[model samples]
Target: MDKETAKNIRESLKADCSNCFGLCCTALNIVASSDFAINKNAGTPCPNLNDEFRCKIHQNLREKGFKGCTVFDCLGAGQKVSQNIFNGQNWRENPEIAEKMFSVFPVMEQLYEMIAFISEALTYEVSFSLHDNLNQQLEKLQNLTDMDADSLLSIDLVMCRFPIKELLLETSQYIRSELSSKVFAIKKGKECSGADWIGKNFSGKDLRTTDLRGAYLIATDLRNTDLRGVDFIGADLRDANLSGANLSTSLFLTQMQINSAKGNEKTILPSHLQRPYHWI
Candidate 1:
């Protein structure tokens, strides 16, 4: 019902985008920001992309004037649905396949977005009971996504609209229920007592059972702190500072979870978490 609990659930439901294809980058139209020149389309590869499927100019994207690119998140659809599902099939070459693939593209994208909303909704304790129900829905959605191309294309778009709308309504209800709650602001300065900080400033803070739901830790400095059982629901951790946080047994942190958090050279993270090339 409160903010803390709602935060954790949302973190999990955010799409596991690493298992996705780079669809949005290759399929949609994106104009260069102040950091770079030249506009591109969804199916067109950005000049920065290399043979490795990574941005060649990632490091200089900002300095080179492509600041907008840095903030873009495809919700993991780039790899999941694009490369994985389509198997590197680009609509540009085969105009015949373009229509179906393009149609399916937005469906999966919408599904991914809905999953994110539901993930955020799950963070609210009020939605705890709804977890099973939502989980079932998620499973159903995943199954739908896994269907063959023919079946996927045949799916009713309206079906997704209802499910997504319903999940949003429930999440909104949960958030509204906690309107009177106070949010915790994890900072870079002195440590807050009873707070968990694994390998971070609060490295010794006893945040073992702390509720860190929906906390906006955007680019905050974190290193060498205890994260035994911390909940990281709905935390907009984009570009946050995680230098030495020990997240061995962290709660609710999935592949997508780690990807969303900020990490850098000095960041001591779990072995499995690959630091985004942009960070290095």
Candidate 2:
């Protein structure tokens, strides 16, 4: 794929809150805990949101106990809902549509996430064989994104997610299969998924092609490791050290995972994901 297409794909998925109506802060609920500073129920506007549809504490969110906001990304779904679905109409101006708007937001969020995954798969050279399939799915979802609020709410998310997930898994395997043999080999016959590995030290390990799905890796030391093609879906990486690690090729690594983890300047990340601000 050309560099420009790849750049456009990434830009389309990145969150653009300025064009949004602060849907995340209003449509979703937040609890008073480590993640959020205060409690808020669904459909209620966050007190921190200002008249300009901007977070008042945007700069000091983590410091103010609203760390959840820093890691959350709607993947550009907010603007699509605000501009395309409702034509710039917000709940504040017309409170009657608040519930419908909130319901449609989550559906669009999941749809956009699938788009992000498929878009990422298209960028991989090893996944070239699946480019046609990914492109078809991308176009379909892009069309769905342009639909009105009623149509978006009617989508069968279960049916839509299953096929996309299968495609993603297959694409991940294709990429992992092509990795060089010189890389560290994952342990054979070891329980790859749902393993409790919290606080374990895996520093500088060769973890290529590892099936680490649903694994509890909280506070694990993964510094400078070769993590190419490792399936990180459902892995808990809270407080994990990923300094100097090569994660550009990791599979299913989401922004939530990166946001919850610890990383340094030496950590190599995928093009679509950004480093967490809390990391020094």
Q: RMSD to native for every prediction? A: 9.0, 2.6
Candidate 2, residues 1-280, lDDT tens digits: the string is 5535854785568778988899999989899988898999988899999988899999999999998888788888998888879888988887888899988998999998888777777766644558777777888888999888899999999999888878877776666665534344433222377878888888998877777878999889999988877888778988789989999778778888899888999999977788887888
Where does model 1 exceed 4 Å of error? 1-22, 28-45, 49-88, 99-103, 109-138, 148-204, 254-272, 277-280
Shift of residue 183 alpha carbon in model 1, Å = 25
As for candidate 2, its clashing pairs are none
List the lowest-lDDT window of 10 residues for candidate 1: 184-193
lDDT of each: 0.54, 0.82
lDDT of 1 by residue, 83-181 (tens): 666777655555576656655777676666556555545544554657776666766766776776678778787876686666654544444334324
